[model samples]
Target chain A: AQSVAQPEDQVNVAEGNPLTVKCTYSVSGNPYLFWYVQYPNRGLQFLLKYITGDNLVKGSYGFEAEFNKSQTSFHLKKPSALVSDSALYFCAVRDLTSGNTPLVFGKGTRLSVIA
Target chain B: EAGVTQFPSHSVIEKGQTVTLRCDPISGHDNLYWYRRVMGKEIKFLLHFVKESKQDESGMPNNRFLAERTGGTYSTLKVQPAELEDSGVYFCASSNEWRTGELFFGEGSRLTVL
Candidate 1:
């Protein structure tokens, strides 16, 4: 079964400092990885996805993720964080081997960007 | 374009009561999906609908849960005699033909069973 693991329960960082949220996955075939953010009283919003090609994929709101195939990791990163960036981040993976399989999500890491 | 919308933002019901959640997918979206996030748990898939037909329902917890999409439009998920364990936030998502995997989610319906 394909699964995504977000090791950190929560990450705290100062505003304007760099931030990283770790994510690792296990899948039988090539993985379709994604990052989503959920704000208070809102639905999950798509941030980025890694389907193929580029190892580094850039996403909305100055976010980027590096897809390390050998490491089985897709870590979300931002050069400079803002207080508004604080939210719950989730890593998800889709099993490419299975036709149109539902995405499996991680437990989610709460990000706190202090001003 | 309007994103996916779910009705009754929050519902509090007693155990063994029936509850029905509604989701309206984006215009012209052929694929709709149902998911839920229980307290202290990761979001889990419940089912997928391709038009009015159910594509995959393997993730549904049990027979007490029933989902339907009539005429390939709006979808509804009904829980008969809900259990306390069923308290969670139910989310609905949709994607069009061009972007099959890129799902747009609704604000979700929060259900509380006591």
Candidate 2:
């Protein structure tokens, strides 16, 4: 079984400040990682994914994540934050070996970007 | 092209009632998925369908919840005898076979079991 863990329930950042949301996972083998954002009354939007690539992956809305193989971590980062960037973020992982398996998501982290 | 669309955006029903939610995937998309988020919990997968056939349904909670995608175009999820625990937001998503792993989600149907 595969599982994802987002240790933080909430993260606060000021406008123009950088922000980081941490996530870690436990899987049997190589993992497929993804990041998604959800706004109130909306569905989850795709952010970025890490299949087989360079450790640093850039995504929409000026966001990026680092996939640390040894640490089993994929942390979402942004150089600067805006009030509009505040939303619920989720980290998910799926086992590639299983072939098109469903993604397992971590409890989402609420991001509050202050003006 | 329009994204995945779900009907009856919000529905409130007493426990033991029935509710049906519909999802229309973007044209040409062959993979459709159903997921849900319980109060304050992570979004979880309920099932996946490739065209008209079900590919995976391991995440489905019980027989009370049923899903069907006729003709492989649109899908419907019917919950009979809804339980209080079933109150949550159900999301539907779709992606073309070529984009196998990437899923485009709908706004979701919020079901409140009173």
Candidate 3:
């Protein structure tokens, strides 16, 4: 069973400040990780993914994530936060067992950027 | 390119009634998927379709749920005798190919069963 976890239920940051949404995963095989953002009343938008590459992966909206294979963690980060960046963040994972298998998602974290 | 689209952005109905949700994947997409998120829960996979064929449906909850992609361009999911627990937001996604697991999602259909 592949599972992902977003340890924080909510993360608050001041605009222009750095932001981090932590994610960790457990998989039976090589991990396929992803990040998605959802605005109120809208569907989820893909942010980025980590298949097999350098530890750092860049994504949409000036966001990036660092994949720590040893730690089983892939944390999303941004150098500067914008008020408009406030939304719900989800972390997902997939593996070989996940042949066309649905992505296993985390409970989600609410990100609030204060101006 | 036009992204995945779902019909009936919102629906409200009474328990025991039936509801149908539709999804139109990208024009050239061969893989389509259905997902749902009940209140306070994470989004979950309901099923996956590859060109009018049922690729995998291990996530489907029960027989009350029926999904079809007859022409392989659009798909519909019908719920019979809807229950309160079935009230949730359903999302549809598609990908042009299987090698790239990146899925483009639609705005989703919000269903409320009272």
| Rank ordering of all candidates by TM-score, starting from the highest | 1, 2, 3
Docking class of 2: medium
Instruction: Name the DockQ score for candidate 2.
Output: 0.64
| Predicted structure 2: lDDT | 0.93
Candidate 1: regions farther than 4 A off:
B98-100
By DockQ thresholds, what CAPRI class is model 3?
Answer: medium
Off by over 4 Å in 3: none
Instruction: For candidate 3, write residues A1-115 as lDDT tens digits.
Output: 8888888999999999999999999998888889999999887899999888699999999999999988999999999999999999999887855565567788889999999
Candidate 3 colliding pairs: none
State the DockQ of every prediction. 0.68, 0.64, 0.61
Cα lDDT of all candidates, in order? 0.94, 0.93, 0.91
Write one digit per residue (lDDT tens) for candidate 2, span A1-115.
8999999999999999999999999898788899999998888899999998699999999999999999999999999999999999999998878666788899899999999
User: What would the per-residue lDDT of candidate 2 be over residues B1-114, giving only the tens digit for each residue?
Assistant: 899999989999999999999999989999999999998898999999999999999999999999999999999999999999999999999987623367889999999999
Among the numbered candidates, top lDDT falls to: 1
Error of 2 at B76 (Å): 0.5
Ranking by lDDT: 1, 2, 3
TM-score of chain A of each: 0.98, 0.97, 0.96
